[model samples]
Target: MSTVIEIDRLSKSYVVPVRGAGVRASIVSLVKRKTRTVEAVKEISLSVEAGEVVGFLGPNGAGKTTTLKMLSGLLHPTGGTASVLGFEPWKRNNDFLRQITLVMGQRNQLIWDIPVIDSFDRNRVIYRLTREEYRERLDELVELLELGELLSKPVRNLSLGERMKCEVAAALLHHPRILFLDEPTLGLDVSMQRRLRTFVEQYNKRTGATVLLTSHYMADVEALCPRVVVIHHGELLFDGKLADLVRKFSAQKTLVLELEESQEDLSRFGQVVSQEGSRATLRVPKQDTAEVTARILRELKVQDLNVADPPIDEIIDQVFSRGMA
Candidate 1:
């Protein structure tokens, strides 16, 4: 596959005013302005090939949104370079804008009072899609997103999930080759989230569009993105397969043991995380899990035992905590 998105040492920063409390400080800040530069993205570099789906993962304030904004030409970068389909994103060129679509979870670009199809039509005009092409794309989206019944209804009457479906359809009306989805499944229930994931997977498979998605939900990343790039504290921490991230960040495995008696202290074997009645959970180093489990089974009259990887959320927490430390 050809390279579709290339980011080289891309960085973004904002000079924010630091205002002190009380009247005198506020007055002083207005004139002189105590400002601090917050680095949102710090020399991050990555590349995406055509027809690839990559997940951009980070915690709140981790610069994920800032990076996406820069990619979509919503914000200018402070340093480094980015090229999407050989066009600089900050230039906001019509050719660059027309080949890419950005959907922010919290921000809706649809007209609330208008019908969903009308909003899509508005995008058709904006993208200058030919009538036949527009109709063909619209029909496909309607069928895929199940938007037939909801298209005629005003956006305000639709539920949040319903509106989101329309929002995605609107963004894709032009059939952009690249899609940037930031928390696309935000505020959605489990079934709706799954449905949206399925739709995204299908769309990518059918159109071979390159996608960059940022989501808080691990399930979303796991389901839709085989490759993940993780950023924290304005810096790139890990960029690889999700399984590799877990393997690298998580040095310990969780062992759940069902004991014949609840009186034994298992802290000697490892860090006992939780214990309830006859069931206890312990975090043991990966290398020691096998030895510890064997010892526990022989000595503690263990009824049942299971070993598993640490949750992705915990691994992420560890990564960020270490970064902070």
Candidate 2:
């Protein structure tokens, strides 16, 4: 695959005025204003190949949305550079804008009072798609996203999940080759989240579009992205396969053991996470997993045993806690 998105030392910063609380100090600050520079995104470099779905991982205010905005041409960077499909993103070229779509979870692009289909048609017009091309793509999206029933309803009448589905469909009507999804599944219930994930997977497989997604929900990342790039404190910390991230940052391993009896105290071996009937889940240090497993089996009769990495959420928390180490 070819490199569809490339950035070298890409950075974005903001300078905000600072003021004192008291009236005298505030009045003095009018003449001599104090300001601080906040680096939303530091010198971070990354390359994304065509047809790849990459999870852009970071916590709240950790520059995930800022980076996405820069890549989608919504914001100009303070320093460094980025190229998307051979066009500088900050330049906002017509060709570049038509070839990419950004879907933000907390924001809405559709007209609130209009029917969902109207908003989709507006996007079709903006992208200047031929009638036949628009119809074809719209039909595909309606079918895949199951947007048929919700299309005629006004945006105000639809539920949050329904509106989100339409928002995604609207964004894709132009057949953008690059998708920048920032928390696409935010505020969605479990089933709705799953449906959206499935649609994203199918869309990528069918169109071979490149996707960069940022979500707090790990399930979204696990379901759609094979590779992940982690950023924290406006810095790039790790970039590779999701499995490798688990192996690198996870200091503890989980052991699920089905014991012959439920009464045994397993705290001697490891931290017992939960116990129900004969099933117990334990968390042990990664380095002593083997020793803990042996001790558990030798001391207590075990019927079944399985060892796995700590949950992705835990690993991510660990990564944020120990930033840049």
Candidate 3:
């Protein structure tokens, strides 16, 4: 596959004034301003292939959003080189802008007090889409998004979930070749979040658009993206499959046992994580998982037992902690 996104030694920094809290420092700062340089993104490089869906993950204060902004042509990078769809993103050329679409959850592009379809029509004009192309794409998206009735209602009158659905449709009307989704499922109900994830998967398959999705919700990453790029302190940490990340940093597995009765001691098997009614959970070392499972089944009246790897969230937390440490 061709390289849709290529970043080389990309970096960004900011200069801000700093001063003491008290009156003396405040007065001194007025005369002699003290400024400090803050590095929001350090030199980081990665290549994304065409039609690939990759997750961009990082803790708060990391450079996830900053890197995305630079890629989407929304912000100028302080240093380094980057390109998307064979065009320099920071240049903000019309040809480049027409091929890329960015959807930010907190920021709305649709006008209030207008029907959702009208907003979509406005986007059609902005993208200079022909009438037939606009109609075809609109009908396809509305059916896939199940926005038949919602499109007729005013955007201001619709619920948050409804409005977000419209926002996604508006962004896709131009059929952008690349998609930058920053927390697209933020603040949505669980069902709505799942629905959006499904929509992303379908859109990618149907359009073959390269996508870089940054979401705090693991469900979104697990369902849509097989590869992930993790950043911390404005630096790259891991760039690979999610399972590889968990296996590399996580040294323990969880063992869940269904006991025949409650109040039975199972600490001898492993470190008990939780116990409720007839179920008990234990954490055991990866190498000793098989031995511990055998011992539990051999030594106790176990109704059922299962062994699984650590949760993705726990593995990611460890990745950040170790990287920051």
- Global Cα lDDT for candidate 1: 0.92
Which residue segments of model 1 deviate by more than 4 Å? 258-268, 275-279, 300-304
**lDDT by residue for model 3 over 53-168, one digit each (tens)?**
99988888888899999999999999899989999998899999999999999889998998888899899999999999999999999999999999889889989998899999
The per-residue C-alpha lDDT of model 1 at residue 190 equals 96
Best by TM-score: 2
lDDT by candidate, in order shown:
0.92, 0.94, 0.91
Q: Give the distance in Å from residue 123's predicted Cα in candidate 2 to where it truly belongs.
A: 1.5
Better of 1 and 2 by lDDT: 2
Residues 225-321 of candidate 1 have per-residue lDDT tens digits of: 9899999989998899999999888899999999888878788989999999999999999999889988987788988899999888888878888
Question: Which residue pairs clash in candidate 1?
Answer: none
Clashes of 2: 0
* Residue-level lDDT tens digits of model 2 in 198-270: 9999999999999999999999999999999998988889999999999988889999999888988889988
Better of 1 and 3 by lDDT: 1
For every candidate structure, what is the RMSD over all alpha carbons to the true structure, in angstroms?
2.1, 1.1, 1.4
Candidate 1 residue 321 Cα shift, in angstroms, is 1.6
